[model samples]
Target: MSFYDVLARGDDALDESPRRSRTWNFFSHITCNTVVGLSKIVLNTLYNVEVKGLENLDQAMVAARKENRGILTLMNHMSTCDDPFIWACLPWRYFKDLDDIRWGMAASNVCFTSKVTSRFFSMGKILSCERFGRGPFQPALDACVRILSPDNTLDSEHIFHGLGPSTDLAASMAKNLKEERNPLSPEYKPPVLRKKTSLLHVFPEGFVCQLRPPFNNSMRFFRWGTARMILEPTVAPTIVPIFSDGFEKIKPEKVEESAFDFFTFYNRGGKVTVNIGKPLDSAIIDGFRDEWRKLCLKYTSLQDSNRMSDELKFGEEAKRLRSKVSGYLREQVSKLRLQNGFDKEDSRFSDVNWWVKYTDTKGKSDPSVKFVGLNWACRDYQSNVKIYDEKGNLLQERKDALCGPKAPRKSH
Candidate 1:
């Protein structure tokens, strides 16, 4: 059977469960997903999202299904919420039009450690890679090859959305300046580039940051692998450059505490905007990492310089952007909820029992929860990956499978 078949089985596992329990899984589908759906609807009712550059999306699978031309869709990283937004904004036919449309995502092995996220969000086979595994990374490498291979089964919907940290961006820049004598930054480096005849989504920024005029010159440059991966003798693929604007609303504030700064905007259901930039000029990107590097670096650096203090200086740039995007994202999300045929809210997870059981450094719970050393959460730390055996220091990665005897069912 194809891998998709197995994913179908996993999806069915939850669906097959006796339909009348007060369990997390039961509540998640029945409640959480429903509420999430409703929230999207509530937001969408207020605005109409405009997708200006989607034609740039090389509909690889669709084209291949028709003329058999594979594509590479490159994008910039922003929120975990990007895909669903794209799904909602694009025509239902675009997704349904393709016989095999999968998403290529880079998710941590730990996020899948839970039955919930493991089984649902990442139902497809996982890449199972560490953040910076410089050595041979077979699992991730294999998964990449398999997903890119047109022969792979369509039973599962594979999406590659690497939520990897962009923090290393600054480090990448630091390394470049220190060694190669150049500067750029973000928290993580993208995986090595590989040349293949399949559709791929590349996020140049490595992660999300928004709303500084030079929005975060701190953009982690797109790893050269993006170029090296495609420039190979393999069938050349289209390289699209995507830029998004609404994420600025949820900007990690402190933009400037001044009444006029970034702190002015918050999710308060404000607008969200995503613009897909036109495809990169292949003549400029093909076999030329330096050219590609220069463009991506300059593209971002130009955005971040005035991102913070600029907003502090300018009064309503963020406000204008937010008003436009918040209205748009909500509309897009609502259309998606409607497509899913869900329009109600589920409040079960709100009880907190279903919330992730978080533990911090020093093995304490609440104390370490405060983001230390950086505005970032400690969740991304190696220490965050709980070590099961104190003496051996085995991480949650090496722990036994979590499918244990059902915990004494909590009677509602």
Candidate 2:
């Protein structure tokens, strides 16, 4: 299939049968082990790496297995290598059991540009996500929710129904099939499946943000996509918050160079620290989950006889709930950062409006923003970007511009 075809269908275009095949398992074992072994070598031999609160992860894993709950690990995104390299800190047992390994999300524009790269990341268990066009409400996030929910079954047809290149008749047939299987319908019945608890690791920030010194480790506001995995699952996942430092040094965001420069990985003697925080309180998450169900019921009642999907009908209230939940999750990570000796982040980082302002000006002010949203092209540490309301009135601005050639230079 063409790159455009794969991108249009998202993760549904990729064949996941390899995950269940014995031959593929043998191949994945060798590939995954080799990659992780190399990562351990690079992380330990080349640099000094320290890991704390690993006992917390151990406990969380044990509890999750015992309780039959899926695991969702949240962490800050410092560099591209943060996933596999960071996994190097995990014990070998996690690698031995391939099912326990994490399934990550990567930007389709970056990771799915070609068939080779697409298959590569897919084999690595990374889902192709549309970071820009679809934003948070994408099919990939729904796939994540399914992965975390025990006994939840989502076939390729269900995911790709009416998506990508399809004839009018085919699209209509798919739509009809979907309606026939709608959970809200009294006649609808789900398939019986074995309970499988999977693990997913997400960078709730959604993009890399290696800020300048004094704020180098600061995280952007957590996106609401992570909230869907938290609230929509049948059983509440074991949420583990993690904080890491020094991956950025291993793969710093160079202004004039590619972010994935191979030469950067050769650098040695950097100190890397990974802190795994305790699992979030189930009681607190249960409270939020209860609130979410109430909102769903309220919204569903207000809908017409031909009710819209939860994605459509939940509307503003659900959005607000997600924002709150995501903020709380981010706060937990921030607390973990503080425990790891980093200074506390500014309170404004928790505000959704602040990020919305920055995202709204994405390509308009800085052409470098590109189709995948913000990159490291313009890192304005000194001033806030100009913020405007929907009516075009200036809401906020600083002495210096946010991006472009006119933006002020870094002060050392």
Candidate 3:
């Protein structure tokens, strides 16, 4: 039978039992495959997307598979569509198992703002996490630890909200951890945990940017959670670096507000370029973490932020290192971007007012851009594809320029 027919069969509780797992498994497999397929076409046709460093990704995947480990993709966030776009470009050769082994951490405020959105994202293996809260007590870190931990200890006990709870607070918190019910009200069944996945994607910047002025000079600094994930012993996920640009060119309606517009998605066109880098050697990342600690301890503020101990006090050094780590990772990403010919000048895109008004000037008062299928887009446009190694050195390149007029111009 068709995929949707099978999917409709499991419309009830997704986690009811092992039978449900198989049902949803079949569903997710079909759905993600469809998404990837459509993404390939839309990305190529509408955006003229290009990719490099497949060899680097392939090598890392090989090593990860050999060791039965996971790869943590560290990326620069430029737009709301960043996560799905990356997944679309990920090499299917490695993820052929289709076991939903990929995961991404999404901002809680954005992803879980409503039940509808929460359900849509949960299917994509996206974990909702709080962006701002007390330091040394991050819920995101706890979530990451659970997903990466092979033994699954973090899942059993919820991480306490704040630093230290008093006698009464401690008892209440302990009880909350032992239950499998909603945190706010005990009567509700806890949402089913997202399926087990290995590869975790994170945009450490904590916020999306359109490369506007002032912030245009450098990629925004990232949080320390990525570094923390790398240092964790549970998965010790290899750090894979990816650089992507051109999403801003679409200039979607209300993009500045960060709301996703499906019309703009279907009608957008621009060249997107991505470069994947080799997994940073674990030894190198570990060594950097060690050096970071020494610097933190030497400075009281840094030490407090490190949360190495409860008695430590916040000091200036911690603040400095926080900025330092952010800059270091941004620089690495910038290097990849530069290698692939992306610079600050090409960081943003805007739609002419006349163009925006022209798309739906007739019957549809509001624009309703239909997603032209991926195959149609690919068949319509010529694409240039390349593969590279860990060093940002090219290993292979291919270009297919079918005979056809270029993608329609989006603006006057």
Candidate 4:
């Protein structure tokens, strides 16, 4: 079937929303196919990018196709360009036609103030414009309903992404799909031997939180949303948690939609690689959050710990992450209720002194390796509260609790 046949039909009421039809979308198959073709040309020859899990994808797809099933490739969402690049580098030759590489994109109406923004992103199925739509925006949700329908033939792929920390891509998918009896749906009612037809791409970090040197490890607690996709028992696609290194080096603001998201000219230029791990048994995700977090941390540290200090590599992402991490610190402090004594809220939450949680990888149970988050206390205040690593050996002895909005230059 033609790729056009695979995309979701926007709205049936041509009389009402004439502009919403896939045909009327001036950027039609010719334009999109040409666009995907150009994507191949630029991605193949442009920069130093190495894909690790492509072979795994091929093997999975072969089995999936034979079984008439679908796939859910969960990954870390770092930069916008990263998704297109990942799709572009897939083992498309095995799929017969490269047009099958297309998937959905999730973005907010941040730029939809103008018609140009709508047209630029209108090529895809969903044209979301709900800022706080998380509550009760019907139209935004109705579009999602059609976009993620369980009918195997309607839409072949969906790219799931969340805007901020609160953005729950996995939750949104699980909840909505649950309405259709997703495998993880508590009230899921399974169909008898039905065929599967879509591929789900998800990044579990929630948002691209900024991270600075030393503590640059991704705080990926795969403890939530994603697990629901499989736990429901109604639908569970083979889950692959892809680990990508070298992408954080590229900034987002520099990524232009016109360039097909490659950002070749703007990027200072560096190698970006994605290591696709094995497809996970959906059931294991439920109890494996802690297990996976340790694994993610280990791999991240072993591969890119040195690079974490190389803030220059991440440019805008680093700046953004640093701001986020800094904010995260304040948020944690606020959660601790340290700031409630004050009247209103401090515009500069950083003004309140708080110690940074430094992961000291010194003498520990895991032996010389593995990092844990901790805040230093002065020698005097270090009394009954003894913080040790996995091994029960005191990593840092503090005399007093350090409280401040910012960590001292010497402390970090």
Q: Report every candidate's CA lDDT.
A: 0.34, 0.66, 0.50, 0.37
| Backbone atom clashes (below 3 Å) for every candidate | 47, 0, 5, 26
For residues 65-158, could you state the per-residue lDDT of candidate 4 as single tens digits?
A: 5555456566655554555556655544523332233333343423243566555544432244222113111233223222323434332132
lDDT of 2 at 84: 90
lDDT for model 3: 0.50
Clashing pairs in 3: 47-270, 53-388, 301-314, 301-315, 302-318
* Model 3 worst lDDT run, 10 consecutive residues: 1-10
Indicate which candidate wins on TM-score: 2
TM-score of 3: 0.59
| Top candidate, metric lDDT | 2
lDDT of 3 by residue, 157-181 (tens): 2122122444343344345334422
Query: Higher TM-score: candidate 2 or 4?
Result: 2
lDDT of 1 at 287: 30
Question: Ranking under TM-score, best-scoring first?
Answer: 2, 3, 4, 1
> How far does residue 366 in candidate 1 sit from its true spot (Å)?
30
lDDT of 2 by residue, 203-259 (tens): 998878776655558888898889878876656789999999888888876544443
Please say which candidate is ahead in lDDT: 2 or 4: 2
Q: TM-score of each candidate?
A: 0.44, 0.75, 0.59, 0.46
Alpha-carbon runs more than 4 Å astray in model 4: 1-35, 91-99, 111-113, 125-196, 217-228, 231-234, 252-269, 282-412
Model 1 local distance difference test score = 0.34
Model 4 RMSD vs true structure: 19.4
